[model samples]
Target chain A: MPFSVSKDEILETVHMFQMQNLDIRTITMGINIQDCRENDGKGTGKKIYEKIVRYARDLVKTGEEIEKEYGIPIINKRISLTPLSMVIDGLSCAEVIKTGKYLDKAAIEVGVNFLGGFSALVHKGFTRGDLALIEAIPETLAGTERVCSSVNLATSKAGINMDAIFMMGRIIKQTAELTGDRDGLGCAKLVVFCNAVEDNPFMAGAFHGPGEAESILNIGISGPGVVLNAVKNYPDSDLGELANIIKNTAFKITRTGELVGRVASRRLGVPFGIVDLSLAPTPAIGDSVADILESMGLERAGTHGSTAALAMLNDAVKKGGAMASSYVGGLSGAFIPVSEDAGMIKAVEDGALSIDKLEAMTCVCSVGLDMIAIPGNTAADTIAAIIADEAAIGMINRKTTAVRIIPAPGKKEGEWVEFGGLLGRAPVMKVNQYSAADFIKRKGRIPAPIHALNN
Target chain B: MEESKKLIITVLGHDRVGIIAGISNILARANVNILDISQTILQGFFTMVMVVDFSGSTVELAELKTLLGEKGRELELEISVHHEDIFKFMHRI
Candidate 1:
């Protein structure tokens, strides 16, 4: 038997593909090293490296087989692990920094583009290990080119930890000032989270959770363009049809996710976890979350029903992903990164989107206060204030959110910086313009929210 | 005689209404009992997995397939039936 689809339908799927006209974005291997620690940070990092390299040796070979089997490209094959800090708490900060370099080396050795889990989780209070991990980030990130770091400093149920925010503020400043001249882009490697998720296959922030068994594989699928094409033709389509379109589009996106992930795992010698079929918005003019809203008939993204619209989109994506993939994990939703989304930047430039409104939106998407481009003249305290607010959202929601604001040193509000290509261009967003020195200067823990006491 | 075997049937192709109902109806009419079935539709494509116990069938495998193939054409599906032994050998985890 044969299935016949029109040539136009085939072309539509092809056109809506990812960077390479491929639907499968990433396949991330989650390696569990509970059995590989040596208590010596350097030695442990070495063993960790060996384990990952050995486990992932077949990854590329397997990936090729799946690509042929499914006919969708799986672009990146990478590894994530339970936070190394959790496994090597006895090591000194310098040793931990050394560990990061080794992990980076391992990634390069095994042919993966990046390796994650140079991280710590201190959403409630800091442990010695967590503190060491946090302190090691600047040097670790600077020392390694292929390692990504993340710290979950807040969750939905816990309010933002002002202490962690203040520390991260100084850390960001230090990292930027240290690498400030070389694009000072060291800060790009780290993510600060509220309710940071475990199975996310995307990066600068994909860490294997401690709760996972020996190892598993997960995939993150992104095709904002695909979903856009679904509803773009229906400018006057009702919201119900729009949602159904999103749902159907998401189903296709996620099935590709499931097929690619399943094939990747079979090829790479690992069990499958979840396929995070998120319609990740990019800085491309046509693919932003705000653009999706505009296509849904909103004049711009920050309008009255924007949050409701996003919530609906998020729900539809989740439902479709759930149906298409057996294991759905990660911050699997439409991303609304301001700096990474062209439409969002335009909205911010037009004064339609604001830091306050972004915070409100993060309550429903993946990554918080993300890729926001703020004016350089903005005080460090204000930056910290922005982080604190985003962290507050994470602390209360138990979802992973992050702030990746680029204070492009000399750029002012409404100024534009062209990152070009995938990173995209960003409009210099306006900050409070006023000081939050008093609010941020009073550096103390913003204790957990009342909901955290639940059984 | 070949009907007295456990087989795995995979259905793949563009998703439209009646694919599931039509396929299952054919299997049931041939005295095949479905042990498990799962299906999903994505990007206009549909795939389904069905495990059937065919021990009580009197119809020939070729005849049943011919019937299913006629319906498969109407629904735009690709159907393949494989014995459990071949499936397990290829898919063992």
Candidate 2:
């Protein structure tokens, strides 16, 4: 059979060919709706809907024209906003839910896939609006399809909020119980963050950060399959060789991201921030960071030397990306979301990985406590300790991190909770039984460690 | 659903003799026009970026992608063919 054949390796090689040497991943639009406020939630909701649709109407068309002229692939066209909760004061939980619907409606009309900023920022303490919005997360997430939310509960300077962490553990459990039919998956759209960045372009937790200028475009790039396939060639390659292949692959991937972000920024009339060069593993089996390590020869993840492997993966992704693009920011390492990555799911099924090991990995990766579910009655203080520990790590390391954990109301350890359709399912892993009341009860910003400032 | 428009062909990864010749031959067979093509090799990495006009071809974009992808596999090189517009629409804000 004489035939020309294209391998995954070759297809990935020219994956970003349209760029004229430009590589594009995501094009995120930040829209401010502060002016859309009204005397009541109902009036404000209408304004919010109209304003978003009107402003974003030309986005898709413009993207098309640019793609045609420039020969680039713009993978995602998304929108972020000023947290709607910030605008809708005196609005009941029901009204906030309506506003979320409006946000979803506008996104659909404009043909954008995802929209974020259904959020709160109460690391220090809750405000009236923040509290109201926090209360509405379960309902709002269950009610809307596209509105993503985040609440920053920890920061380098402000530290973690034990009260919010405590409340959130219960809230996640309650939300799961309410949305049990939907796999209690509403939590996937929301992330409780420590040092959440303003420029991230990925979702569930990617809000337009507070420092965003009027409206700017940011890009996030992911191609775990590309990296996985690149490294796959040398099945018997050693650690250094495997690391080199990952670095080389990421350099090209990041270059693609930089090219796309700059061009989009120019077209959209907004300045571009850094490119998030995260591996961003998908639910697909072959496209996982864990699978990459397994390919490097691990029986399964979370054994003695697992952290060293992860540390190298994180460092190499950064080194390559930093060289490929000057505008690199956000969490640039491989995302290890428990439900999202195939190997992690299998590890849980095999009982090889635990919550503590996952937490330990967060010390090296971009986000914290990703896609994990716990028992409903897990004490708020215990949850607080988890958040505090993650916060302390982020504070010490000075990297952007987040936690989007769910506590399934009645589901105990080893029970599988499914958040169907791309969100995936995960067997609830074990959390520690020991209490840390004294540590969590102190409830003040753990002062930034002296070692953080060392150059 | 927008129609795919404007084609871009890129070649990258390892370099070997006849890499471009084989790929360009496929485009020629399809009656596709190469509007622009650029290739560079640095640090032992071979990179090539091209713009193709499928407006002149009988094959759909996917067919071309598949066709060239095959050639790429034979040579152990990376090759990509795209609608110049999809990537741009995705990139352009």
lDDT of 2 by residue, B1-93 (tens): 244445656677798899879988998998987766667785797877666667778886657777887888898876665544333433332
> Model 1, range A1-455, lDDT digits (tens) per residue?
11133323333444454222335667888888767678677788889889988898877667755553333556678889888778878778887887788899889988888788888878778888888888888788767777888887777666667788878876766665555554445666677777778777877788998888688898988777666667787887788878887887777778777766665666666889998867776655566678777777778898778888888888888887777777888878888877667788778778888878888888887767766666656677877888888877666676667887666666777777664545567777777767888999898778777888897
TM-score of each: 0.77, 0.79
* CA deviation > 4 Å runs, candidate 2: A1-12, A15-25, A60-75, A89-94, A234-241, A376-381, A436-455, B1-80, B83-93
Kindly state the number of residue pairs that clash in model 1. Answer: 20
Using DockQ as the measure, the top candidate is: 2
Worst 10 residues of 2 chain A by lDDT: A1-10
DockQ of each: 0.03, 0.13
Per residue, candidate 2 scores C-alpha lDDT tens digits across A1-455 of 01122233223444534222233546777777778888766688789889878767877766665554444556568888887667876787777877778888888899887788888887677777887888888888887788888888866766667677766766666666677776667777878888788777778876766667767676778777666676668888788988888888778778667766666667666777778888776576676778777766678987666778888888888887888886887667888888888888998889878888888888888877788887756776776677777877787777777778777666888888887655788888788899987776666455556654556
